[model samples]
Target: MHGHYRETAECPGQTRGESSGGTHLQMHGHYRETAECPGQTRGESSGGTRLQMHGHYRETAECPGQTRGESSGGTRLQIHGHYRETAECPGQTRGEREGRVVDGLTSKYMDTIERLQSVQARLEVKAQTLERESNECRVQTEECQQQLRKCQSELNRQVKQSSCVIQEKVPFNDTKTSDYNSLNVPPHNKRHQLKARDVAGQALGFVQDIVVALLNFHSYTEQRVHIYPLDSSIEPISPLNQKFSQYLHENAAYVRPLEEGLVQLHQSITEDTVTVLETVGKLKDFAEHFTSYTHFLQKILPYQLKSLEEECRAPLCTSSLISKNQELQSGMKRITSVFDKLHRYIILLALPSVRQDAMPQSSSSAVFTQLAACLHSLHDAIKEMSKHYSQKAGLEQQLPTVTQKLCTTNECLLASLGMLTNSTDKIATFFSNNLDFFTSSTGYGPRGGVGVLNPLQAESMLGNKKKASDYMQAIRKPRAESVPYREALLNRRVLTSSTESRQGLTQQVVASQEKIARLEQEKEHWLLETQLGRVRLEKESQRIQDLETQLSSALEGGGGSPASALSLGLGSPALTSLDDGELEERGVEKDAMINTSLVGMLTTTPTNEEVRDEESREQLIKTHYMARVGELTTQLQVSDSKAVNFHAECRALAKRLALAEKSRETLTEEVKLANQNITRLQDELATTKRSYKEQLSMMSDHLCSMNETLSKQREEIDILKLSGKGNSKLLKKGR
Candidate 1:
């Protein structure tokens, strides 16, 4: 045992493999402590540097006291990716005459293989480092490319501005025929005029680009105003608060004063809390309600939501599913509306709004339960479908991008989550463990990507998904553009890209000078700010002195004096921003207030040294020069444009005069034709008058004839009358 050395590197790695066994034996032959391996295979440690091996776990055993102590991590060894288990050490290891039992050829071959493997490993390590560097370079390259893009955009903008300037300087009529004009315009003016027109189109596009950027900036500010607040729960005039107070007022039919809104809010909160608790307290068990529709929560609701499945199972159709989800959302809204009031006291994590919910007894647990059931059902469904939906099929259809939960770095869909999305919240609840990552929408699933479904917007979004193809539009369609970003604001992406732009380096000399001036002003402002802070600090010190005096007097007076004298009259320091020794003392004083008479005696405040700091800061911003620069640029552009207009106007006016003369000549001809038409019409009118008079005379002659005939008839009638009288006499005689 004293003359033997055995190689065992079984924990995970090996250096030189079995090939160097012969070499090892030759080297240790003279050393009495070296022992030949029973298997005639062992390698000298490869520079004694540990190498990590990645492969299936393999075991090789070495007896105690036989090893030279070169071991991986266990009493085992492997050679050339081959594992072999050795028995307990042979008792005759010392007596064994190793007369080259291992053939030199085989030993040499193994040694060669091991050397190659070692070389390969080193190469692999080198490759890994190279790959890491490559990735870093690639990232830097991408950043450079982005900066290049911004540079290009800015360059395009400058070109467009120059074009616009030239276009403005060279006046041209928009209505002028663009085909060809050789009247009064020379070729030089015409060439510039043509360039202006041609470049104006590109300028217009550049202007649109700038406008879009401005709009995006405007929206960014809007989002900051609405969402980027640490204390968002305390908005006095928030719409939700207004709605709460308004609802309270309407509920009791009382128009209370604005100052009492907080009192009203507290009353409402108390009433709602007590009502919800009482409603739940009366219930002996929640098992019955959990079961009534628990199955749907699992098997139907969430599955349909994730898939936007229209063809429902036996019990639920699309319409019923939609209606149920709407009802569920309504319940959730109510629950959130009630419990959301508690966020005022919750110091750690809280959403601006929770999108909370409830079930019968209206307990939040039921809401939570139903959400769990839906997710469990969805997950189970996924598992079942995963059985049938082959990986090959998934790859071919590109389904994982559309269906799998996002923000997971792992390749396999629905298999394992790399991390929880709500790790920031760190909240423990009934469903925290089992249901945290239940579904895509609820709990700790990816909520930010383009196709991510929000639990609050699930109903409308799913409905839209079923009926429409525009999922991004549907997901983003919220009341405020910022509404879609609210949860993201709370649960933001932890990893952020570094920002840089090429635009700064490309600024004009004026802009650079302006920036220099701005920095100088900022330096002055900071100096002034320090002075102001000193004044405020002095005022705080004065207030502290007064409080100390009041406290001392209170201690001296004891319980015998008035309550006013007993008051400690402590007021917190006004200058919280300063981090100097005095402010640290102030902070220490605040900490000291934690234990004593400092609590109740906080009424007194020193005279406020600054009331208009915000306004003062605004006034100090020195943007007038920047604006003046723009105005001067505009005026220069206008002045140049006016001079260009004089020349352009002369030619244009000359052309217009020619056109006007031609128009006037045409008008004279038209007037002559119109007069001829009028004279012809008058002659026709006279003929018509004469014809009318002739017809009237003819009609009168015909009337005279008609009168004479009537008279003749009258005379005949008289004759008849005389005959009738004779006839009547004859008739009387006959009678």
Candidate 2:
């Protein structure tokens, strides 16, 4: 070793150097650079730490006092040429594989979130449909309930019709007979169309057709209210048919032929009973028509009056009753009020002869039987009066002028009837108007709620997706501290917040699951409500169908038999016990022992001995009529009870419908809240994964960078060794 390999050391700590042929190497303090043979190059750094390149881009660096067991920024790594082991550090490999696993988990989680969002969208739609259907059902239920109420009112009116017949026309005490078999009549008069046997516990008039209410002709009453009580019986103003009773007492001979021809002139009483009974049923139906109309007024008027008073008191009310100036005697309110009071007072005037003491609630058979007995008594009275009038023989001579007088009085009665019909129509129209006003003033729908969410409900669910994705993907690989080879990057700090974030994510998942279970319960409840409503609707529809059938038969004149019209009148007489007085006498209405089934037999039968005796024949006739009256009275009591129960069922169904709709609305709200929570949880989970992934990615990058730097230094060391060997040979040759 001579001057050719001599050291003019420019390196740190007096390091060795070589410059031979075209190769030169120099080191300065802690920095070194080399140029070896045309294109070869090297670098070195040494201070408190050592950094060196050994061969083919291999590198190593170690701090002072660092040992083989510990890490000191030293790693073995290099890029091989054609085929060799790849440049990879243990830390980077472990970190990169784990990061990939984390990435896969993130992708799976995001997929789950997207799927959950779609499911929530579908649930929202389903909830909306249920809300819509329930609303529609509620609306329909309201309408049906109103219609059913109206129909029920009408049906009740049908049951308690024609109170006037029971209240007056026949005196009850005069018709009463204690002994039916006193004038013993045997079962002897068995004709072709009529039977002689009288069935026990059956009304005489109901079983055997005899002249009944129909045989009593329409009579002109003395009282008249031009607009109001032409056909009605009101107290003090327009008591019905009073003049007819007076006429019968006063001018008995003038109108006697009509009754005598029908009742007395029949070929045989039993043979002609069918014709008489059919006519009586129809006459009863027509009489009941007017009476039911009065009853309708009784029901509707008070309600309308209450409504008028309520309307007058309501906020922003413009009712005519509210204006004192318009409520004079000439006003509509005054007129209607008078009509209302008079209609209610009509019962008081219907019988001026001790009406409270009078037995009123007689059935069809009872009415007919009582009328028959009274007519028989009257027949005897007419004959007795004729005996008195026959003494004064001018009664036959005065017939022509009497006929003219009777005709004039009949014309006046007809005129009053025309006026009564017009007034009744007006009152009905007024009552309907009040009903409309009351319904409008109240927000009267049964189902009440606005629970369904709008279409924009989904807007807040997927909150700021762009911002979320950016946070999730934001990452730069990390770097080690104070390394000279590569630029330092921000080292990921210890994940202190990770534990808290993990716990928070777990809580979110648990909360979402709990909400899901609650959603399940609510959804089941909603579905059950829907099912119940559907079932109730079907039942209501069936009830309406039966009503339609009954109404149609009545309207079509009762299906074509002679008894058809008769049945329509006698069939299913409504007993409106809920509102109107179903029975005129409460004690009489409780006929618990009454048989509904009609036994078609007369109570009394005339023997030859009884028929021959005039007083016995009359007594036998009276007993038959009284027995029939008692039986019919018993039957009327039974009908009134059944009608009361049917109405109660309708009310309960309506309440259930309202309850079902409210439950459905609550379920919809719960589902909406659950969907919101799920979306929030999805966002939170995505955020957590992004934070964890970013931290892990940074750590992998830092380890990879360190490993790569060490590999390059090792490669540099190999190249420097080859240059030193060549220089040593050149130095020897030069020596």
Candidate 3:
């Protein structure tokens, strides 16, 4: 077994041919040894050798050159086939065959091993190619994913940028619109009016832009915005323009009424204040007069008192007691009179001043003058009282001492009234200052400019314009020759309000009347419309009743079909719900009955009694038909007239069109001619210019030529003269 393993191990490392050769060599060696042996001479030795070789060959064929030890190791089993045939082994046919068999087995085994190795190599190469392909696919997939990510990011960025752009532009456009809406100031000055017109145009442009943007937006909100007309004012402000609308809404309450009321109140109060100032002036006058009267009375009093004393010393004061009593009584009367007059004067002074201060400015002039006159009268009365008081004072010295008391009361009352006037003046001054403040704040600038009487001045100008127009109208009147100009002027006064107070009242009345008239006109218009509507409704109702009667008759007759019934029921509201079958039967019956009734009615028409009735009915029907025909004829006539007029108008229009066309043609021809003329003129002008330039150049050349010729001639002349002189000198020399 060890020798077999060594032989198999060597056989595995060596080619089959080499191993077979070695086996032949071994067999040959064995045969040589055996041939030399005694067993070779004997037949027993040959049989044993042959059997042994045969066994070995069978084993080699079975295991394919595998020895026992080589099989046990089982790792280095690779071999190639090697054939052996033999002359070296003389009696070794079995060994040689065994070697051939082993060689065939080994060759078969080697072929299988080579095939398996080739399959393994092919599989490994396929796996390597698959791995490389898979890796490349993965890299490409990763690259595609990166590109997708980059595209997604760029798309997102563009989306965000587009959204931002839309947002910015949308708000900017809305803000511009809001600015326009807020600043809808009135146009006063020419520049402002132009600016306002420009703003309106700009606003329209913005609106158009907004409309376009909304269309582009393609959103529900934008679609809804478009449902309303762009020019519609009723829509609420857009989100972007809300700020200005909100501002207008929030501040509207604060501004409008207060400003208007303040203006009106300022004008009213200023007038009142002016009245108060005039009243104060009146009071001042009264007070001055009162003071003067008091002085005059003081000077006149003594003389009047002495005269009273002298008069009292008559027969009525004969006895000493009677005369003295009478004197005392007379003195008391005088003092009482003086006191009464002084009290009356003081009261009058106080009241006139108070009234003057309280009177309305418009009435102030009259009131002031009246108060002044009353004060003057009171002053005279006070002078009379002072005279009586002075007389009483003289009498008091003689009889009683009470006159001085009366004089003191008069002085106190006069002084008190004087103080009252001073107070009024102060009050007037305060009011005047307040009026100035008020005028500046509310009455001037916006309402009327600059001065207190600006409104009045404007009114007066308007009045003058009216008067001038009236005067012109009067002068233009053919019959005005009978009416004096002054009379006409006087009559014109009636057309205007006489007083400021009356004028204001009349203005309010006129305004109220105008409002009432407008309302009445609207009411009358509505009433007329209502009446017309009612008349149409009544006519419709009557026609409906007649139709209903006819429908009822048809339904009752019940002969004809529902369609006929329905035809009879035309204009009838009463038979609206009649079903088809019922209506049909009713219509048939109604048609038959109507036909018979018409026949009977016609039968009566041929008889004398019926003839009259038939004639009247025929006349009525004929009249109605004639009236209808007349109406139709009138309508036809009207239509024909209209057509004629229209035809004439069309002819006129055609004439005008022809004229316009002719004008246009003329204008076109003129324009063409003008263009031709312009071209011709341009060409002529150019040619003339060229010609002029050529002529100028030619003239210049001619002048230059002439100048050159003249110079040459002069040079020739000089040369000739020189030559002559030289020749003469030569001649002289020769001589």
Candidate 4:
């Protein structure tokens, strides 16, 4: 049964044999495997094998006599009862010592076990603490997560609220701001415009009020006044006048002579006022006539009138209509009143002169003079009025022609433009339809369209059209004849004024010419003096140049002396003591004289070139003298300063030498101290070297002791090996 069981357990490829006697059996196979034995199944054998294995996976036979399986590596093995089997095993006493040693080892092992148990207890406590910390950390983590969630939710809420608020407020803010801005902007602009308009309107109203007030004042002041020139060769009534040709012929007053004179004066004022009133009346009639004519023309010819209507409205009719109108005015009434007032003022101012002249000049002459002035003024005013009338007539005659010409020209221009437009359109059509023909040879492809041009053809067409247009345009509108009329009026006024001024200035020029002649004579005197001064300046300049040359040579010479240079007048005795004080005084006096002379010469009105030359010469002379004095003063100052600085430097050098000597003594003491410190450091270095050598000797002794201990350990190891060999031999014998 055993053979059958063994055969069944061992497969064909396994090597198997029976060993020993019937009480013991040994089976071998290629490898380990679970198989059925005599009464055991493969499963039961596997279970029995497992039961035989210890907790450490050490396999021991379940049979009491069976040996345990051995695993071999580098470690030593000890049998249970062969404590003394090793060659180095101790005798009984030595065994006792070894037992004691083992006892110590056991105690050490127990201590290690205790330490391990204590370490395990501590680790368990620590683990409990770590677990608590982990739980707390987990709790903190949960709290942090909760806080993070809350923060996230809060942030989201805040973001959403902010978004909502911003969404709501942004438009509201923008709308409100826009509303505010618009409110401010429109009103501000409107207010500014209103202010400007109000100011302008107020200014216009003020100007109109002033003009109306002036007109009213003149009308009121002139209403009661009347005056006329007296006839000469009549007996004078006023004692103050003392004139044979003048008489007071006032019908209202027959009083004392003074009172009679006053009455005459008052009558004359009244006459002058009456004259002004008549002039104003004529001005008003003229204005009204023009205003009526303009109003009639504007009313009748609402648009432009035809030539027939203009021709039928004769010049006299238009003139009469304008003269009869009420608003065709240039404020002439106000001007006439102002002129009358001016005349009265002049008369009053001339009264004293008139009285004085009466003693010699006859009263008739005085009256004639005044009447002549009045007639002259009246003639000037009448001439101005005639010129204005002629200007108006001329303008009236040319206006229709200008307007007709403008209309005809505009129609012609429109026609020309229409023709040009048609030509352009035809050209454009040609280009668009036959684009290839214009640019077939050019690399630009079809370019006859409006955008593209055959350069020469386009240029020729444009040039021809431009030339024709320019030539046609050159047939200018007939130059407005009113321009010449205005020029003629201006020329007439100028000629009249020139004649009047020429006549008045004729007598006055004689006295003026004599005065000019005397001035010219005085100018000749100054001219002579200036010429002499220029000559002297030239001589002085030559002397200065000579002195400069001599001084330069003296400076260049090897052995020239200052005295020799002075003898040559390069260093004048007069200039030797001239410092800034004297130079400033001289400059001031010279400048004053120059200014006075320059003013006199300028007032004399010298010719342009003469003035230029004199200015250049004066500037050159002043610059030259001033530069010469400045150079001399600078040289003197530089030499004196050098001398002074040299003395100061000498004293400073003496003081510095004493200080340097004291510093050298201090350096000597520092060097001695450094030498002593060096000596102390050298001694300390020697002592340190000695101590290092002693410590090295002690380390060498320790190494020798360690070598002796290693030698003893080697012998003990050899003994152990020999003992191991004996044990192997005993085992072989036993086998």
Q: Return model 2's CA RMSD, one decimal.
A: 57.2
**Model 4 misplacement above 4 A:** 1-644, 723-735
Error of 2 at 52 (Å): 64
Q: What are the lDDT scores of the predictions, listed in order?
A: 0.40, 0.39, 0.49, 0.44
Clashes of 3: 17
Which digits, one per residue and each the tens of the lDDT, describe model 1 over residues 146-251?
Answer: 9999999999999999899879896764224322121211112233334333333322332233233323322332222232111134453344333333332332
Indicate the residue-level lDDT of 226 in model 2: 18
Model 3 C-alpha lDDT versus the unseen true structure: 0.49
In model 2, the runs with Cα more than 4 Å from the true position are 1-608, 611-644, 692-700, 703-707, 710-735
Higher-scoring candidate on lDDT, 3 or 4: 3
Evaluate model 4: give its lDDT: 0.44
Cα deviation at 677, candidate 2, in Å, is: 1.0
Point out the higher-scoring one by TM-score: 2 or 3.
Answer: 3
lDDT of 3 by residue, 1-735 (tens): 334434455446544454555455556556756755643565776666666666665666566655544543332222111122333444765567679989999999999999999999999999999999999999999999999999999999999999999898765442234322222221124443343334333333322332232222222222222221121144553432232223223332322332333233233322112221211223344344434434333433343333334435533333443444345445434533443454344344334334322332334344434433443443343334334444433443453323444444434433333332232333233334333321221211212121122222333333444566578788987763477899979877866646666889999999999999999977754554444335435655786698778877897798888777876666345345666687688657644543455311433325453455445545655665588799999999999999999999999999999999999999999997797567546755775798799999999999999999999999999999999999999999999
Which ranking of candidates, highest lDDT first? 3, 4, 1, 2
In candidate 1, stretches whose alpha carbon ends up further than 4 angstroms from where it belongs are 1-644, 727-735
* Per-candidate count of clashing residue pairs (backbone under 3 Å): 12, 33, 17, 16
* lDDT for position 728 in model 2: 94
Candidate 1, residue 193: CA error in Å? Answer: 56
